[model samples]
Target: MPLYQLNETFWFPPVTESLEDGLLAIGGDLQIPRLLNAYKNGIFPWYEGNTPLWWCPDPRFILFPDELKISKSMRSVFRKNIFDFSINNAFESVIQYCKITKRNGQDGTWITDSMQQAYIQLYREGWAHSAEAWQNEQLVGGLYGVKMGNVFFGESMFSLMSNTSKFAFISLVQQLKEEGIVLIDCQVYTEHLESLGARFISRNAFIELLSTNI
Candidate 1:
C-alpha cells in the first residue's frame, strides 16, 4: 500500500490505506485539533528524526479496565507503599522522563521536543493526563496519555525503579475505571503490558469501539 502524505489541512487519509506495518501517513504537525482528531479516529503519531509518522495497526492492542491483572509481587509492593501515586501532579516531568529513559532496542526517543510541547498543550487544555510515582520526594516513574470520552490513548511510560512504571500504570487504570473509562488504548504491544491484560482486537473492532466511546 502507498503511504499518504499529510498537508497543511487538519485531516488524515482513511486508516484502511495504512501500510502493512500500520503506518498510515506522514508530515503532519502535532497541533491540538489535529492530534485529538487522530486519536478520535484510532490513529497516533510517531516520529523518526523530524518527520511525523501516523499509524493504525491491523490488530489493535488495548486494555479493558476490568481485565487488569496485578501479580503477587506487585501486590506486595503496593502493600509496602514503595511508591506514592498521583494524577497530573507532574505532566511535563513524566513525559520528560519517558523521553530520556532508554528502551532496550531503541537508541533514541520518538517523543521529540515538539511532540512534548504539543502534548503539554493537550494537557493544559485538559485532554491529556499523567500518572506519577514518587519516592523520597523525588519522581521515580510514570506514564502520560490523552483521554477522550470513554477511552484513553496511552503514550509512554518510564521507571527508575523496578516495576515502578507498571505500578504507575496499574494505579492509573484503577482511577480511570472509577471515572467510567472502559478502554485504554495501548496502541502497540509489549510483554510488560500483555502481562497487565492488554490484548489484541481486530482493527475493525477497534474503530468500532472508538466510534462508540468517543
Candidate 2:
C-alpha cells in the first residue's frame, strides 16, 4: 500500500487507513504545514534518511503525566537538587546532542539532517519545545518534542550523565501537568520508557484520545 497518495490534491487520508496494509507508503516532503497536519491527525514521520516517511503503528506507546514513576534513587537525585531543569531553553543544542549521541543497542540515529532542520523550525514557531537539564550551568541532558494543544509528542531524549535525562523528563511532565496537558505520546515501545511508566494502547484508542483530549 502506498503510505500516502495524492488524491486530486495533497490532502492525505486518515492514517488509520493503512493499518490493514502493513508499512503502507513511503517518500514525501517534510514541510511544516504537512508535519503539523500529520501530527494533528495522529500521524508522525520516522524515516532513516532524506526521504520523509510517515507512520501510524497499530499499537501506540504513550505516557500519562500522572502515571510517571519516580524511583527511589531518582527521587534522591531530585531531593539533592543534582541538576537544574528548564523548558524550551536550548532546544537546538538538545536536538543536536540527541542526533550525535550513540544508543546502547543501535548503530545510528533516525534523526536525519532534514528532520533536525524541520523540528528546529517548528521550535522557532512555538510548535516544538524542549526540556533541559543543566549541571553547573552546562547542559548535561534533555529531550525535545512537539506540543499540539494539550498533547505532547515526545520525539527523542538523550542523557550525558546518569539521571539527567530522567530529571528533564520529570520536570517536563510536571510543567505539562500545570498546563493541563493530558497525553504524552512516546510513539514506540521501549522497556526504558515502560520503567518510567509509559504504556501501550491500540492505535485506534490513541487516536480517539487525541481527538477528545487535544
Candidate 3:
C-alpha cells in the first residue's frame, strides 16, 4: 500500500493499512494530540528526518509484568544493590543523555530535538514518565516512556554503565506491577529485552490487549 500522508487532520488511517515493513504513514506533525492519538490506537512516530513517520509494526513486542525475568547475574546485581533507582527524579538529564549517547550500529539518534520537546510536554502533562538510575548521587542510566492507562509505551533508554539501564527498567517494571499495570509495550524485539521476557505477539492480539488494558 502507498504510504498515507497526514495533514492538519487529527485522525489516523487504520494501522492495518501499514506497508509490509510497518511504515504506515509519513508527513505527520509531532503535535501532542497526534502523538497521543497515535499511541492510543497502537501507532507511533519514528523518523530519521524532518518529517514525522508513523508506524505500527506487526508482531508487537511486549512484556507482561508478571513474566519479567531476573537472570542469575541480574539477580546478583539486585542483591549487590550497587545502584539506586528513582522515578521522575532526573527526567531532563536522562533524556538529554539519551539524545547524545551512542548506540551500537546506529549513527546519530532518533530522539530528535522536536521529539524531546514533545515528550517533555507530555511529561509536564503527567502522561510521560522516566525511570532513573543513580550512583553516588550522579545519574548513570535511565529510560522514558508514555503511560496510557494500564499500559506503558516505552520509547528510549540509555545506559552509562553496565547493567544500569536494566536496573532502571527492572525497577520501573516492579513498580508498575505493584500499581496494576498489566502490559508494557516494548515496540520491537531486541536480544537484551527478550532476555528480560519481552516477546512478540500478533498485531490483532496486541490491539486487543491494548483495548482491554485501557
Rank by TM-score (best first): 1, 3, 2
Query: Which runs of model 2 end up more than 4 angstroms from their true locations?
Result: 5-10, 19-22
Candidate 2, residues 1-214, lDDT tens digits: the string is 5456433233667776775522434666678888888888778887755666667787889999999998999999999998999998899999999999999999999999989999999999999999999999999999999999889999999999998888999989989989999999998888878989999888888889889876
Best by lDDT: 1
Candidate 3 Cα misplacement greater than 4 A, ranges: none
lDDT of 2: 0.86
RMSD of candidate 2 to the truth, in angstroms, is 1.9
Candidate 3 lDDT by residue in tens digits, 1-214: 8789999987999989999888899886888999889999999888777878888999899999999998998889889989999999978788899899999989888888999999999998998899999999999999999999899999989999999999999999999999899999999889988999999999999999888877
* Residue 213 lDDT (model 1): 95
TM-score of each: 0.99, 0.93, 0.98
**TM-score (C-alpha) between model 3 and the true structure:** 0.98
Q: To one decimal, what is the Cα RMSD in angstroms of model 1 from the true structure?
A: 0.7
Native-to-model Cα distance after best TM-score fit, residue 123 in candidate 1, in Å: 0.6
Candidate 1 local Cα displacement, residue 158, angstroms:
0.1
